[model samples]
Target: MSIAEQFPYKIELHVHLDGAIRTETIVETAKRRNIHFPWETIEELKTHLVMSAPPYHLGALLEKFHTFMPVVAGDRDAIHQIAYEFCEDCKKHDVFYTEARYSPQLFANKMSDGSKPPYAHTEGDITPREVVNIICNAFEKGSQDFGVKVKSILCCVEHAPEWSNEVLELCKEFKPRGVVAIDIACGDLDPDVPHKELHTRAFQLAAQYGIHRTVHAGESGPAAGVRLALDEMHAERIGHGYKVVDDAELYERCRRENIHFEVCPLSSVKTGSVPDDLDKHPLHRFINDEVNFSINTDDPIVLDNDLTSDYEMVMKMGLDKEHVIATIFHAARSCFAPPEEKKQILAELVKVYGEKYMKM
Candidate 1:
């Protein structure tokens, strides 16, 4: 096998739980629930789920999950199974450590307003807290079963002020139970229209309680979105911050603060957040500008990408072996895993990338 194939000791910081659903799980779960999906077979399901190349839509980013909501939004076992399979899939793909995220608001009784995640009726009686516990416990089982390290982060939707507060409370209550940090995700409006009042309150609680902050900014939104997330909510890490390269001041501040960028190259292209053309992607600029970043599969199965594929993509896009390796280390540092776990993964990375392991 080539070095790319043998590339060892991976870490991811930006994968979405719902966005990364396994097609087979989606198919089988839908079948059991009598829920209908557009495709009949796993092979056919991949056509709608995976983004082979770009010219993909932003609506397609989370909108593809409309068919998936019935299973996830309704059932605890379905959520647990999905979380377990996500870790299993990461281990099979050679990821040793990872931080996964999800928005809890989407699950709790979907709304009649403009709010998303249409409520899917469930025969089972389950609250969102129970749902969170089920998902977290399933991650623990998957870690034990697959020998991969996984941590969960909860997201509060940008526009859902009330739900955002509810999700933040969950983050505080579940911090010791494998939920590490809080995130505000999925606002793609212009930078000037800040989603502040409720998000700020939630983040203040995070600060008081020691929950780390990661935010989705500068994605489909402009570079100013990155600055707003920091200024308004104190974002410690940015998800899909390619637009930071477009603004010199933000670039300099990110470098000085050691703010990590969770760069999901494939998702960037597919969501129209960055260019469809890989060569034109600002990952090159992030490299040139010395911004801290970690390559990630924002949605693995959905985008037809995993950590290894992203490693190959970056290498082909002009990153050398050292940068390719550094990205993993960057993720290790920025990951929400415990300090000792972080140390172990870093040591393992050194051992694998070191001459001793390579020679062996």
Candidate 2:
């Protein structure tokens, strides 16, 4: 059997909703929304959207979001369609459960007061809160229709800490609707952003109120960012935390705490976060030390990959089937689903992969 077939069940903790929109969906949505862009055909769009080469930095990769985001952003139907389709796509990859994260602000075109502009190109009445509502509604229908469990992590953009408070509130408001956590995504870790305090305060509130927290740190930035996330934000997990290996003390602390790392192998190389040489990847050290980490496809639409692609890359990096099975269990344990849902997921995983693989 193929590697993917051998591991029939899988779980992913880090993927972006905006970054995973179907190319066909983009094409159809753009045409309906009357949005204009460079590429119209799917093949041409792939050439523009897919990052086929390595050594590209995170900022350059993120800029690509603007290219198509305007097409679906703020359109209620488009938002619902994409969220629902995401569940279907997850099922296609044999992913039984996944958490897709995105900044609601980026998908909104106006503020709560019906303001003129937000992140999308055209201004409209859609607000970030409304965006969440739409996605949650669609996720409910999609999960039932597609037979895949999908949840969301609302993001606090690093550059827009002002939005962090509302993001926290949204997490609290939508917890029952599959909104499991709040995360900080996008932008570099710059000290000069005076309003960065907003993110910290919001994260603190999230902790007090029991919201699961994850931060995007130490991917392309320094390991110090990872320390900041833990110290200030109370992050239970780190996103793309490859650089944590740079600090011996912090790495030891993380391993000791069993802090989960959402490791995206192909994305690490594609974003120039790790060396192109697979042998020199930080994941090797993670495996040797048995650190708590899970494999994921960070942005399949942009990276031109899927869960299968990430699994295949790790296998090519010398991981055997047993290691693959272990990571699935790692993800299942680290996921932010509520107690009973998490229990059910764990039971299903053990039933498929066997109890022997759980402790690995």
Candidate with the greatest lDDT versus the true structure: 2
- Estimate the overall C-alpha local distance difference test score of candidate 2: 0.89
lDDT of 1 by residue, 160-193 (tens): 6677777887898888888988887766524555
Q: What is the C-alpha lDDT of each candidate?
A: 0.78, 0.89
For each candidate, how many residue pairs have backbone atoms clashing (under 3 Å)?
0, 0
TM-score, one value per model: 0.91, 0.97
Instruction: Give residue 117's lDDT in candidate 1 (0 to 100).
Output: 43
